[model samples]
Target chain A: MTTAGINIHTGKAMPLNQANVDTDQIIPKQFLTAVTKSGYGKHLFHDWRYLDQHEQVPNPDFVFNKTEHQGASVLLTRENFGCGSSREHAPWSLDDYGFKVVIGTSFADIFYGNCINNQLLPVQLTSSQMDQLFALVESDASAQITVNLQDQTVKVKDLNFGFEIAEQHKTNLLKGLDAIGQTLELDDKITAFENNLPQWQKA
Target chain B: MATTLYDKIWQAHIIDAKKTSETGEEGLIYIDRHLIHEVTTPQAFAGLDEKGRKVRCPERTFATMDHSISTRSLALDACGPTNKLQLQTLADNCKKHGIELFPVGHQKQGIVHVMGPELGLIQPGMTVVCGDSHTATHGAFGALAFGIGTSQVEHVFATQTLKQSKAKSMQVQVNGSLPIGITAKDIILAIIGKIGHAGATGYVIEYSGEAISALSMEERMTVCNMSIEAGAKAGLIAPDQTTFDYLEGREYAPKGDNWTQAVAYWNSLKSDKDATFDTVIQLNAADITPQVTWGTNPGQVIGVNQPVPSPNDFSDPIDKDSANKALKYMDLAPGQKLSELSVNNVFIGSCTNGRIEDMRAAAAIAKHGKVAPGVTAIVVPGSVSVKAQAEAEQLDKIFIEAGFEWRLPGCSMCLGMNDDILTQGDRCASTSNRNFEGRQGRGSRTHLVSPAMAAAAALAGHFADVRDYQ
Candidate 1:
């Protein structure tokens, strides 16, 4: 079984309310040169958060620079998160940057799959549910919620909401199985099919 | 259940069901219409040579030079070092193997995805395979088209088939009326946003519904072109009057009585009214807006008025962290509106959004306004005919007067295969797919958007909504 990282138990949810969070914004194109996924975290928003070339720096008004949510782990966004190009690096950067769970009204199809496959939990909440979570985050910056993969429930205070996950995908994520590993789980069936092919062709 | 387009096309191309060599697995399905290009063909061809095998059916295979040829109108001889060898090699390989090759300067030379349908090689009721993901563009013609790797390319060359598993079918029906300014680009972007980019993976998307049916053949093609971006095998709208009209009297299309027979069969290449799909997604056409990519991938996008998402707004640490990172690279405030963002250059071309219609759309905007100062802008058509048509209508002159460079077509700045590229620290609003860092060139920043949006951005010298101008 895959061991859980830092649990993003949050009853408080701040809604980004924006649509279409593209991959380039998640991990800027500048950081894609490295062969490995290492060291990309530092540069993830280098230009966005700070101005290195200019004498003036740190636009304190930026959401990432705000004090209330500094070091906040869980992220909640509006509809259509991760919509743009299909660079696998987008998810890789997200996984490496200490995000354990992402709750949104919806996500771009490829990014959602990549996030799920890479062991990052991307929860699709109803728009109303997202609004509620946003309200919680706005009221209490330190609000805590529980996302229990075992129960497939997202807990916020007295409310526990069910989230659907494909059975196979759930199993693979819990077990830290990549596509190859998951494909290997059906090895026996594959072998059986192979064995039957040539003989069946003759028939 | 009634037969779907998927059922009809898949049935027509099934050559054999044979067991695998390694495990004698259940017989895998074979395919026809194998397509190759410079990006993935060299190694496969080399592998074949090493194995001492001749191309099994060179006639069935076709090659083209788009990924590595200069789109500059200055002639093919002037192509830079990077593409010269690859371009030459494509011609040499096609000559040696007796496969049809569309080298630079040939009327057929264009994006492999564009040329396939234009040449009628990708027809109804056939299985088409290419080494590029965008090959799914061919599926618009009722063909089963998808991308494959080099090894798979070699397999098709050797045996004209591939080992494959069937995919579940998904139908995305978009009904209702599209707004006047809305184009196929907007429809696709809106779909990706609605369904998420990977929503269609492991499935072929059959686009139906009222809006799709009303679209022109070219419009349908624009929608199918990006099916791969959504992680689908392909996308298609059922062939109809538009298809018949476009194919009539074309070079490769069937003629006279043969055309009648073909149309009769083509009419049958649709999902039956009562047919079912594994999943059905219904969308309203009026809800979509012109889309733009703010991040590296096609899925990371926003409407013209939306603000960039900030990480603090997320409950998941990864999403927060990733958003923070994206905000950094894009050099924008997460909470800031997209309209306020500035653009350095505007590029209107590529397999995704480059076409005669695309050029015309950009020209429509350019005709009314001059490109904003300091905004470097260009409009590269998809083919020679497209360029000629643009010139015939004086679209090129209109673009030129508006300070947009009009150039020959060859995947310019789409994937940086040739000399067309963005310099370090240059930010461009592009009409191409993919904004992977340096995808256009080293240290280049690309924001993907619709052609109309690109034109608007050029006029504003920044990211702005076309609706404002409209």
Candidate 2:
């Protein structure tokens, strides 16, 4: 479990609406060397959100920089959001930037796992459903959406959509259980399995 | 049950099958091998220390420094203070945990994916993983390998097990023999070009067919390395005689009776004759041409003879918009021939195309000519072993004599993590994967191609057909 874990959240929805938004764009390689995961939110979408190399001036055109969508806790985008790199820092930046849920038509596998690990919900909806959410956010920048982990539902006004998440991920997110601690309980099982392994299977 | 090779391997790794667990469906799958690099493992080691947990299986774990290390030289101080800290942290962490580390200057040290296979640390019918998207490179041996985030890395360090949801199976069948000059890099780029980058988002692709079967082991590794570019966590080819041959004399491969047992097990790892896949994509090798990326993403590509694509050329609106954004970032005009444009830089290396075979292919082209004036070219081999082998064969002389810089091994100019960066507005023909905006460096425009193609471009100072040079 984490002190920063979330179960239910409702806030303004920001529409990126682009497909295949990769990790390099999410957080550029230059900022990956920090000793810890925090302090990355400022650099989230660093290349796209900044007008200059120093990142001092925010690009006014980016959705996240727009005054109306400034504290959005939900990100609504098109297909294959977070498509490259196994960088958990991508989700770390998203969580640090106050985003509780990433709504997409589809998501890259490793990126999805990272989001679950960090308690940043990755909510997958159909293409049309994603279109609807994009339309909702585009029409009213202040539009708020609610994500309920227990129900596995993402609701924007009256339009409600169901999403699928691994049962294990859901339980961990809801209970704030740390994955490593939980696995440590299986030490005996691992030992037993190792004892019966073939020669080539062991180092 | 009609089980695929993927199913067989995935099922074999299951330590526990949990049907009702809140954590995962496949339950706990044992990790047979773990490869680590400096960039992602520092946090994982710290996480272990935070929890006061030792590495559950240090013997199965391996560490290396690549991502942030200096490729300019072997000395630790050559890396800037920041990179030095990251490298030192990994070495210190590995020592504390009793894990083996191939540090800088280690004769076998190189890129994680490159060193792993060349050393025979990876094998067929195993579950391999690393905190890198290119861990799929190991899947070329028919291992069920995939990338994991640092949290998963920490979890693996603590338990040597992962709770995973099995991926759907996909078979990409490449039919007929590859035409001359069409390398595995071109085939994979062509595959991603046909199926958009997100085409296989939720599946683990098992490549099969005449074209796939015909590829060398290193070529197969090149293809599987870019599985992440296709948005799949892993892609694999079955282990055949070719795989066995590649592993026969490697440092870590089994010996004598153990080898016999291993080969027998690997043979059974293939899919049954009538097995079915969740999805199938078909491509004929004859139709594929030398591919060149016209836009930022790997999927936004065209054949060598084709013109740079306009946004209007794309049928999907998302693709159209993405094309517009890419063209603008790359500062290229649509409808213009890519071959007519000049490149200021050419880089031939990365996990995708940094092996001995890749070196030979590029060296063949470089030996015949000099690097074009005003163009800067560099050859960064994938690992120390690969570099030594290339040097032994005098391929380094060919590159250096052709005016291309002969750099040491690391992921130089691939992600631009080190000082090997592209200056602003530089256009480069790079053998590395990913052509994302600023991927090479700020304001850098990258054209992805095979090593032969990159070498040809270096000779011509422009995007030239490798077939023409050969």
Candidate 3:
């Protein structure tokens, strides 16, 4: 599997501070009508980010609407981010919105899978670690936080936090490899197994 | 070692399995049936086109247009431009890839989950996958069926395999017979209430015991269909004579010598007596009544006779917080009687409850009287075949005569994908799965119920207990 390698990322972290943030909140169903994946950034968090139906006015109360978080690329949130609905568009919207990393206490299974497949990294940190990162980011919005996938560490000035991820996923991301590409490499084995199947079982 | 039904099926479909380098987890299980829908497959087909790859096994794959099409009419051109484009893209993609597609106006067209088993394409011991989460509905046949992302969809299209980590096993046993009015939807809702929304996370549940075995094939599908709502990866029941009977003569089912051989294999798909699960839970069917969701999540449910629960009733902070938010979104007060809540709309369809049996249950109630003057009720058959069956029995006439719209087969109000939707602040008694805020429409309040309960609510213009109608 080959992927756009991401050994290190340094960016401002935006704090969402919500739990069980579902995919609908990430990207509303109405915005999912687009045929391609590229144009979803503008509609990310449609209901929360916008105050009116036309989406011409931004909701100032929203985290993303604040001036300080304009160019933020890392999202920090509480547990169970991206729950409900297995739409891969959630990650597509996030990735299109320029978020390279989403750090949360936990994530829904399918959303985590989708993020991994889409080249957006979802980092699971302990609750205390999440609190530390949030506190650090909040204390100084200008503080640049760095995530090093090579060392499995998240560093914010004096504080450094360690995280764990599956080796295969880590390798896939680092190599810019698509999952289907990796699976295709095992074609010889797959074809061999298909050949050995009974006549009735062959598709 | 005694094997579970999940393990047996998982083992049977293994083309290549190995522990991943990071977590040492099993990976790469082959899929037997890959079902596709327009809503989630467009991106996947685009991925295939980008790679210039063909569908690995066209015979094992099936495509349909459901989520983005209008269920109000059979005319394919009647859908809005966005939905029309999605349907056209799906049809074109299927034509390009040699995949079998049941497009709008086709007799086989319906929700992907519903059409799979209805066509007898989902058999016991097969590994089934689809881009939509409700694909778990096929697990009722004892298959390892689960929803997948578009990336996985493309992977399955490319290799007919998925890299998966083994899920923990959970066994839920409903040991007693249910009362007359309580249907499979009620039982599943009751279970979800007991086990909160995240109770079955990372687990594949196997529902067993007398109650499960007693349910008809359609009822079992209803149970498995909502497994994802409870956060389960998949849900399964051991294949039995009822399962075989349901599949025996269907369109894609085996025939003659193959039928006999298939049944013999399905018989061996059940779990061994000594097989152990990670968790075991038991519920008495007698303790359950007709259920309805009082909050935004399916897990926030209560019996029809019960009052709405206050956030104060929950000790956990997370539960209390979520309950408060749900109540605010749903515009409900504590201590309110669920049966007294008025509904402006009643939808008795979706992949969950759009089967022929579900239509029959609703027809029985609508036949008794007309829909209440202020209510807008719609009954959508799961598939064109189911619609044909309902028309043959004149069930559509019963519904139409009662002022309920008899519509074409598609996933309508279930997710607000089409024209069938509730206006803002409108409360609906819906038979579809998921009561999430805005699931049906913006600011729409959904109370999940069975078809009979939805019909009863339609007639009464409020949440009416089906038992009273019975």
Candidate 4:
């Protein structure tokens, strides 16, 4: 089935300056109890975003808890934005939490893949670009950034920055095709190869 | 032309390769084996059902119930309702797909990484993918093994192929002889400590040099298992005679003429003598000491006798901030000796260090006497077979006699998906991987150590150096 496709996104950016913000901190293990991928938005960044286990009080110190950055849809962070575990729940949490674009200097390979599969845009910018974005977002909490997937460019006011993504990944995202659906398009080729395998090697 | 070991394996597995539209790099490599576990596969199965697709080459896929299975008892019925539902879903999925499953309490049931090698399902020059990140552990046998996301898992299940891009290759060459009390765990921990947590990002590491060559298969597995902890895509050691020897008599291995041919092929899987790597890191074995993580991440570690680091010690602001947070979460002060930190629990198991050798090492320490009063020590084997072998050798008896609980095999307390978890605010010396905040249990502080060190900590009721116990 075709997944959600994104061509352009314009939204307020949330600046989380921390580097190497791992998947565990994004969505702690305790919150992974749900078998399905829904309802994770409420528990995103469970530990840092909340002051207690009951999650009733927001941690005022955390950036997301600030009222100025409320309803932000873009996440601006430092390098290795998604490190540690390969839990797809991480991206699920981010997606459910209403983040449509993640702009960072770098991302862990698996997390990047998970984000792509879930139709969340993971944009890789240079450290200087990231610093500029973080500064702009921090200075004006309501500043809106526009990310154009087709043009591979991110823009805010007069500042414009170009980025790079794998061509196939760009196509997949534009077409809203999940990897499994794309692979299924090659069913004939896959079956032919499997059928031709030597008897000893056949499963 | 010289080719790196990674090139050899990657080239061999190209069912279809095409240049990516963006980078013009080759992508779409086929997977030979797909390993599944209870925690990561349920959603994939649902996706498959939604798409009305059948599992292609089910024989090439294997499933196990490890992550969420209860390890407190041998009986599968002992698992609680939620865990039982997960286990049941996994079993049902495997049955529907015709995939072989090593369910809970099965003789072959164990941690996916541990059971793959023990059953000889992992072979040299193979491409193995798993839903779990520790799938890199299979690279010990010269396979191209790495973790994949749930979407990728569904892709592999439906087509036995993965869309991929090339990864940079790095060689970590550790030379010289290891010092006493040092093990593979210490070597990997030291490597992480030296390189920081994200040093090997976007690359696959080929561990080489004399120190790596000298390790046994189990030790090699332990080293490769933690490659992901350092942010590497995978870690591999070219199969040598030692690898062939280890696989020769195991179940699922090729036999007779097939074995002969496999040996000849495995011999050719090594990197060429003139092969060049994108990056090379050289480490001296003599420089490594027994290691223990004192912070939230695996890289926040020091030698056994080293003092906890001050945040000021870090030159990078981010690293310093991480250290400060780690210290607060771990409830420790700077400059405190790691050996002086008291532990409320000692856990000796997980895919990282839960092998027969690790068990023997812990048993050697437990044989001395009972564990120190008030220390809750438990030994959960990596697999049912490992438990059986340990019991056969009376290692379980030694642990039981020393006041350590002998439990069934699974990923117990490693990720705390099961009942075996550290209580909140409890300090634990664990032989498992990942000391991240709440990794073992919510609000629990974890100090990652070697099996011997964990056992020693159990006996001393603190982080005692294994060398002192010896």
Candidate 5:
């Protein structure tokens, strides 16, 4: 299956039922030496998948090891997702692992901001709404949830759940802007602010 | 209504409230001091070089190599591969930009946050920025201090000012006296438990009340240092006689006749009796006991005598799932007594709890007992002066006799930036913040508790309460 962005219009159903999944667990500390986020996918669950016997995949009971959930790009998690260490690598690894959208009840403040900046759609939903979505994904292995950035809604079967996106954040994500890019978007305003500063303070 | 200390300091630093043409609707505040460390400075300096910029306020910017520097190695040659490279890079950057560098073996070389206050570099009514999260430690001196990112680091280097939003003020007042065995660590852990990690977001917390006032300056610093762990912008204590005494005769502190003037100014830094805050939280000091973290996050803590709760105990499914997942990773049984759990390592160090008082507390406990045979215990002081004082007081001998490694001063095992780390699946009784899985090392299990509790655990070979040992 080709893993890419999941659009609300294209329609599919995928969900990851987990909670309080910290950044340290997402990508182990051993891989932190790598300066960039380019190759963190294979080592996503280093301890969960690997064994003492030469790094082979082990722990068949682990959640990510389940066969049916393989290659599902949309991750549906419980509340307070990404609730540890401020490592930006967590979302980087998740994005690299083909997850374009993470719908959860809530997220850590830093991680949520990070995911948004990195173009990963972190959807915050109500618990009852998330419970309904979780039930739909559990019922069908091939079921895929559709998340439309344009509509700012997540649909699991006929049940439609509305998700909020700040108008500025929505525009930035749609255009794929980081903090610098976002700042640059208001270039004229920034210039005006600089020009307005008193000449004595301009040094 | 009377304004809190946060309001007083914040209003003084605001350069502009109007929406800036370049930085948007951000308030540009003048930065009085800037601290830099090895891990976050290289990229920031590189950015400055790319812009052909000299540090705009070299006098305000000070660099130190601590995050990657090993506590074991005092000499440059003994520094490991990564640290050696980091130190060299730091030296190069500081020299190139004419910024002051606290190199290895220097008296001032310690955790950037610790050294800042000791030298009187961080003072009252000042805006301090550092590339370290624990920069808020300086807030103990009544300064408005907080951390910023590498890009912000460069911005401060070029402009000597930071663009920031004003934070709301919070007063966390703990009244009455603490229990016999409990310390400031217990107070902070209890606070983190009472208010969830994100509860203090966007607020500068001012710790007050008779209990806070009773604490020594070092004890106050410990509490303020961990304020960031609760996601607070900063934590502070009103300046008192102890604060003035500690600052007196310091290298950068006001000298001669200026000392009197400085003290008069420092006295004014305290909150007025009728000062109001955005939020006020009260806790009875006598009610708190020795606290320990049972789950991955700092907020998932309980009193040392309490049992770990089962996932089903929580009404919220989100809380339940987090508790369940934490139990799985920590290999802890639901409803199991925390005091009965065995520990393999005991670490008594970090910017959080590595002060002299913490070392003295651990030594007092370790002096009476020996570390369990299988337990690997280490006592790391916060700075060179702290280590010297420990040795002077024979505290190092006490730890060594008790089978704990009396290591040098630096941040060690406090996130495993250096060689001190727990091996895979090894559980540690840590006196640091954040018990997140693998935080001490890859696949390492961490149980966060107070220093005295860590010492008790080290002696007992399990997570036992310090009151039992006392």
Candidate 6:
């Protein structure tokens, strides 16, 4: 995944240490009322993070509220992360909450795409790799993980896990490319495709 | 190379296929239809405004206000200021963009999935997308339809194309005739139960075999609507006589010569006889029973007659953990009979089970008895047209007389975005798709079932097997 202008960054890791976390849990539906996207940061994991609806009582057991995991920008979770709902608010909330990278064994397709668009890199590693990372983070909250987009590798103490992502997705993160602008460059091709469409397609 | 039904549609719309990703072929796929709703589009519309971009193809795009609007009353001001502003934003955006909109008060307006097919806006071989997960509902028409995030919505708005690496194809073959009283909802719940929630991840499922073909177009939609519940972006059935007949005389359907030509092309849209799939799953239709989701995810389901399973029931530790958590949240113990569970509310609606056919099935059961005194039962039709059709057939009367509330059409009680919601800690037998923790309301629990099961549960004041009613 090495390319020009690719940047590598490291951050303290926080372990959610759970699987099948759906978007509803990421940012609940009640908070989806805003027309703007910025205010969802405080409400991320609204239900699990708080014992009350008003955010008055922070659940002490939740990782995000745990003192050790505070200020950690990396989120480590297990399989099927972001499994339900097509809400981009899930990624927006994660990005706003300062998570630079989400490493999981697998991700739901729509959630993966949403994360890429927002530059919240979703790195998929093997189940064993995830387990090791989770253990590292759990044992030492101050553990830092390096994400090298150019090398497509996540590095921690004595472990360098190479992960796979789509080439275009990688490029977009590195370049912060405008997808709409790039697609418009193919306007001629789009027009040609539309013109050749069958009569039933036009209606 | 032999082509699957999914491959045939994907190949037709692929603008470029030279790039390959870890999953499969990566390319730009053209979208023919883009559906928009209130909950996910305000940001997308704002992004478009920030870029000063016009919608690439307004005709192909349709807008609606369903998710957050008040379904109890259609009046614009009935929803609080927060919801009103969001609804206004969509209405303004649609007017400015010149996109056809089915606003909240429109008779044709309902859930996007329910209204899309009724107007013939979705057709075979077309690629459709929306910002909501149930967008997969359109795939029942043999279209390559999937949900997208808001950024993808803006991307589609500006380019009318999606950048995606093709998902591997899986064929779920449900052969043999369905047993009496088994419906499409039962079959899909059974499928999810067999394949865990993540079983279909990274694949586009093509449901085939005699059982799928026998389903009506509406019933096929019921099966495809929950594709996301199993982690698949889309699931499709091959278009056949039933599909064509359903679309034949609809408003947006092709007329005369175009109609004749459309059928000819659609007839050729099936998979090749020797087609290959990356994964194949076979299940006997006879084995499926009326199902209910006892756990949070759709995959954690069982037949109505069964007992709640313990975490030990799942061999995998991760699954075992999820089960323990879900059981704790659901407040049930292992070996507890599912039928003995009492429900305080019955919600029969959503994109999954809110169509006319769903209404008829539920009403058929409602006619036999009154809703239990303390149980609150409500039937929310999928669309305005579905509401009218139900009323015309006097199905609404049966529900009302049986003490079930006949409500307006919206995704009310399903996602609990609208005014209709369950009280905290209320247990509901619902016909909605997801039963995620707090989906209905904070501390509210949902038991997913078919419409008939929901109605029967209302009558019996507990989780009752629909087969017993029959």
Index of the highest-lDDT prediction: 6
Candidate lDDT values, in order? 0.69, 0.89, 0.88, 0.88, 0.76, 0.90
Q: Is the docking of candidate 5 incorrect, acceptable, medium or high quality?
A: incorrect
The CAPRI-style docking tier of model 4 reads: medium
Q: Candidate 2 on B338-402: residue-level lDDT in tens? A: 88989999999999999999999999999989999999999999999999999999999999999
Using DockQ, give the best candidate's number: 6
| Model 6 residue B242 distance off true place after TM-score fit, in angstroms | 0.7
> How close to the true structure is residue A158 of candidate 3, measured as C-alpha lDDT?
93
What DockQ, between 0 and 1, does each candidate earn? 0.06, 0.75, 0.64, 0.58, 0.17, 0.77
lDDT of 6 by residue, A1-203 (tens): 11133358799987888889999889988888789978788999998999999999999988889998889888899999999899999988998888889999899989998988888889899889888888887788898899999899999988888988778888899998888888889888888888888766774
What digit string (tens of lDDT, one per residue) describes model 4 on residues B1-470? 78899998888766678755553356667788888998878888888898799898898999888887777765555657767777788889999989999988789999999999999999998899998888989899999999988888888888899988888899999999888888999999999898878889999999998999999999999999999988999999999988999999898888888888778888999999999998999999999988999998889999989999999999987799889989999999999987778888999999998999999999998897779888899999999899999999999999999999998899888988777877679999999989987788778999999999999999998888788765
- Per-residue lDDT tens digits of candidate 1, residues B223-246? 888886777767766777887787
User: What's the C-alpha lDDT at position B353 in model 3?
Assistant: 97
Worst 10 residues of 2 chain A by lDDT: A1-10
Range of the 10 consecutive residues with the lowest summed lDDT in candidate 3 chain B = B18-27
For candidate 1, write residues A1-203 as lDDT tens digits: 12343233443343355545655556654343332434555554444555552315775755666778766666787766775544445655655655568888777555665575557788887877777777777777777777877678888776677887655446656666434333334446544543453321211
TM-score, one value per model: 0.70, 0.97, 0.96, 0.96, 0.84, 0.98
Task: Give candidate 5 regions above 4 Å deviation.
Answer: A1-16, A33-76, A88-103, A112-123, A132-203, B18-26, B49-54, B75-80, B256-265, B270-278, B468-470
List the candidates ranked by DockQ, beginning with the highest: 6, 2, 3, 4, 5, 1
Give the clashing residue pairs of candidate 6, or none: none
> For residues B271-306, what per-residue lDDT tens digits would candidate 5 score against the true structure?
778988888999999999999998888888899888
lDDT measured at residue B219 in model 2 versus the true structure, 0 to 100: 99
